[model samples]
Target: MPINSSLASLSDMAFGTAFVIYLLAMILSVVFYVKAAGEKPEGAQKFIGMTQSLVWLGIIVHLVSVVTRGLATHRFPFGNLYEYIAMITLFAMVVAAIFMQRREFKPLWPWVLVPVLSLLFLGGKNLYADAAPVVPALQSAWLPIHVSVVASGASIGLISGVASLLYLLRRWQPEGKEKGFFGKLAKPLPGAKRLDLVAYRTAIITVPVFGLGIILGAIWAESAWGRPWNWDPKETFSLITWFLYAAYLHARATSGWQNTKAAWINIVALAAMTFNLFFINLVTSGLHSYAGLN
Candidate 1:
């Protein structure tokens, strides 16, 4: 089906507006965190409330943008790299926002908002694509199913990994009463032990979902290409990412590899997923090339 140009334009407008809102929310979150560093608890609460409201508002607008694109195209609206990135960003934001519902995630708003804002900016500014029908390969029902699961896992992993990184930073620089910049940053973050546990549990929950996405992709591949494991660049890198996470989890049960080392492995897994998302799609050639819109 052809795109409705007017609807598509409206969708783009919403997307751009959402990006600005997310950027504003990111700034507000940082201000909120900074205020939290001081002794003014009431003032800090004011900023935090404002930040949370902005984030939720941006999320609602973004959701409408995604849905409007789907309406414009009468499909999932993720045929090309632009839509793919947009979906990933949207799903990530949704998950991050849900986690933020818990007050424990309050201090992590800025950390969460930065990536979401960056992704929305790049997607809107540089990777914008008009609403279009899916490519032949993407016409199957499997791609959206596979992609939603995989993207959700990626988002969960990314945010949890960021928490792990913060865990390390906090460990390297303990919380103190000083009003310095680093001190302020460290004060709000949960301890390394707490962060590590959160990251681990998140990984545990996400890995199976990601694995199921891969399984579905293989099923789709068998139908599309008459084979399930052709070792495409994207597939291969995805497997590598899966294995890294597997090893990280297994190592967690080991005697000596359960602390910072496991956290480091999760970081590497996060990097591998990033490379798969961008490098494999953009720089490499394979069956998934259509996904890059190349």
Candidate 2:
């Protein structure tokens, strides 16, 4: 078999296997948390051990899938939206796993995965790509540099959003007085205060990385498109996301915008970011239409 073809097949198999493993981790996590709530006699530690191990295993498999795809394409693997989705999600999973190692963030470990899994599912099903030579538009040396950093920044920002969302949903469950299925689930989540800390810290790290990414893109654009900024739909929306995040940080520093309000702003920031990724890249035609969907 051809090397690229063999690698592509292996990538597909790895992607599918990672998805199944993540699903199993989610199930195991649910069981672990339920038992941790003391309703069952079985040890929760064992389940958590299995869940964490499976999570790392899934990450390794997904990493293999991404690396293989890049090898198959004989270029950077981030040329299309399909590839972007898978790789960015891999970054998110890595961040979530690191955060999960913290005791304050441990209980909500599996919850952090719910979004990553969903994105992976979407990527694997709807945005999958076959290995091929990319268009000249994607031939720039910056493909691996600019786009990779941008994707990493975006992935880290996604984790911040997940933490913020969890904070909002479980902000009221501190005393465990709340009664409901979700409430029980929320019981293990870090308190609003802790979640806020993580969200803020994570966002802070992302800001500089994302900003640098935009700047790098500008540099690439200057070389590729004869101008640094074209006000393209993708660029415009990216600016919007950056400013929204800026406003989120600003609001946090200002009066009365701390807690829930700031959380909402971060959520909206994430929403804008997601919209920029899908809608701008897929629905609208522009310079960033490298999604390869058509």
List the candidates' TM-scores in order.
0.93, 0.94
Query: How do the residues 155-180 of candidate 2 rate in per-residue lDDT, one tens digit apiece?
Result: 99998888888888877676457567
lDDT of 1 by residue, 44-88 (tens): 767777888888888888888888888998887667877777787
Each candidate's clash count: 0, 0
The collision pairs in model 2 are none
Error of 2 at 232 (Å): 1.0
Q: How far is candidate 1 from the true structure (C-alpha RMSD, Å)?
A: 1.9
**Candidate 2 TM-score to native:** 0.94
Candidate 2 accuracy as lDDT:
0.85
- lDDT of every predicted structure (CA atoms): 0.79, 0.85
Score residue 13 of candidate 2 by CA lDDT. Answer: 91
* Candidate 1 wrongly placed segments (more than 4 Å): 39-42, 177-181
True lDDT of residue 59, candidate 1? 81
